[model samples]
Target chain A: MIDFAKDVRLWFAPSRLKDEGDTPDYRFSLANERTFLAWIRTALALVGGGFAVDQFLPDLRWGVRVGMAFALLAVGAACALRAVNHWVRCERAMRRHEDLPLSRFPVVLSLGVGLVAVAMVVVVLLGWTSGR
Target chain B: MSGPGTDRDAGLQPERTRLAWRRTTLASSVVAVLALRQALRGSGSSTEVAGAAVIVLIWLVFLWVAHRRIRALATGRPPGLAPRSALAVVGCTVALAVFAMAVIL
Candidate 1:
């Protein structure tokens, strides 16, 4: 059984970087990857969480099912894009000797929160209807 | 494993990863359990529930592997390179989309 994580670790080893410094660009980049993985996990959590909603709301219509799934899918897609965005920003920060980007949190958070809001409305309507 | 304190700190990374996977796996497992119930209950009469169970179980296995791998990396044990799981995940997702269509339609 091969271990891809280890391989990834080796592949991104800071020694491979052209410059190693106290600024810790490499460290930041690696942290970026770990954080991105965390987001992916969150996306999966949303998907799983959405399913649990389904179990209780079995009589739910397609809109609810699909709506919740759409929210989860959006979260997943956003995470993937954020992963690339983070890495690129980190790399650029290293080149410019600046801090890694800080703006992504607000953007992603707003997007995630917005989707949850819409999903909640759909769930409420569907769940309420199913109840009666 | 190539920075100040990072050498001594390498152990923390795996712990964090394990924690993330633990949380994710637990959530996914719950989904599986719930999906199984839905399947038995014939909720939506959708094939997605069965698919959910399979996805959850497979993810559980992946989580276990992730946990073990973190430990291996932390202790400086050799990690034989494994193939990327992306292709398989993508395939599972495509299957999921099709199943969702069947379930929802």
Candidate 2:
């Protein structure tokens, strides 16, 4: 928990992340950078999905629409935060020659997306039935 | 066992990274356009207009940064991304997501 607090504080101090240890191989850093960019893109897609659901699903019930859109938006925000934190941790570890950090985020993200997809299927079926 | 010291894949890494940046820039552009569309199509209240403007600014900043990074990678030995620049990119991404959520709400 202490580490988490320090990271939150570090949000305002970006330069400090690179201040420690020697710079690792440029390729490794570039790979890390690309990974960070990928995560950011994923976050953008999720946020886009949120608004798309909100705007495209005019027939969706109000409560369900907002709930779904909010869920997507929340996940997007979380992903954005995770991307930066992971990038910082990876960069620091590389500079210090420590083992790369591990995370369960990919598994969790997949599960969350799966759950949303299932809910979407149910919502679609309900819409079909209600119209008939 | 190829390692970091190996030069067998020289240039490829940076090339891929540059491509990734380009793709991300395109993705962000799409999101920005969508957000703008939402803002205009909605009630067009002053707050929504301001929010849209902020999103546009963030998008432009991100594009500039990504474009700069892409150009840097074209060199034989591109420097590592600055920590501050990494933070700036992440900030723009998060801000974009927040604005998108706001538009939805």
Candidate 3:
């Protein structure tokens, strides 16, 4: 039978995993960690922005309010998930002595933010035209 | 793997990384405080208050973990790339987002 206990330990403790390839410089690994943290903070900022928009902004149509809030939260959730995935990919690549994987996160994130900005503009215009 | 001598010679890499961690933690704390303020200003419902409290608690925990990591780096200890606490912080942040969404909607 497979050792579930060992599998659990490995799953929880990435540090315990054996090194696969030549060790890269500690600087690179530290940099990777810092990048991951930056992404997490970005995600937090998006989430906070979502909450603020929903709470503080004058009430738009129900649909628009909900849509914008969902969009922001969705992007934030996606960013958080990507942060973890990028961290894992970078760690694996470093372990294997492979070139770091290319990340499309910045592009996707900017696109999402741009869409949200456009939506907000539309929302503001709608609110201005409609008396409420 | 960095030896102690090499770590000392590394010329502020660890220090910069530690600072990055601190900055991230500070950002999270700011977000948490904003959330708390929003919750209080709004309906002041129990769940919103609870959610804000949880966020503040999680941010504190993150700061503590970042502190530990900085100390480890200062001592030239290789404390691994990702700590479980970092994962916990991510999880909590995501949860906070979801809770905020629910409250808003």
Q: Residue B46 CA error for candidate 3 (Å)?
A: 4.2
After aligning candidate 1 to the native by TM-score, how far in Å is the CA of B11 from where it should be?
Answer: 8.9
Every candidate's chain B TM-score: 0.49, 0.80, 0.76
Which candidate achieves the best DockQ against the true structure? 2
lDDT of 2 by residue, A7-95 (tens): 76666676676677988988899899999989989988998888787777877787888888889888988998898888888888898
Order of all candidates by DockQ, from best down to worst?
Answer: 2, 3, 1
TM-score per prediction, in order, is 0.56, 0.88, 0.82
Q: Candidate 2 on B17-65: residue-level lDDT in tens?
A: 9899999989888878877777788687888788878988998999899
TM-score of chain A of 1: 0.56
Report per-candidate TM-score of chain A alone.
0.56, 0.92, 0.81
Better of 1 and 2 by TM-score: 2
Please provide the root mean square deviation of candidate 1 (C-alpha atoms, Å): 8.0
Best by lDDT: 2
Name the better of 1 and 3 by TM-score. Answer: 3
lDDT string for model 1 (A2-47, tens) is 5334334433453433343334433344454456456545545554
Put down candidate 3 lDDT per residue, A17-61, tens digits, no spaces. 445565677777788888888898899888878777776665566
Backbone clash pairs for candidate 1 read A2-B81, A2-B82, A3-B81, A3-B82
Residue-wise lDDT of candidate 3 within B41-93, one digit each (tens)? 65778876787777677767777877788787776635555547557667767
Which portions of model 3 miss their true places by more than 4 Å? A1-11, A126-132, B1-7, B42-49
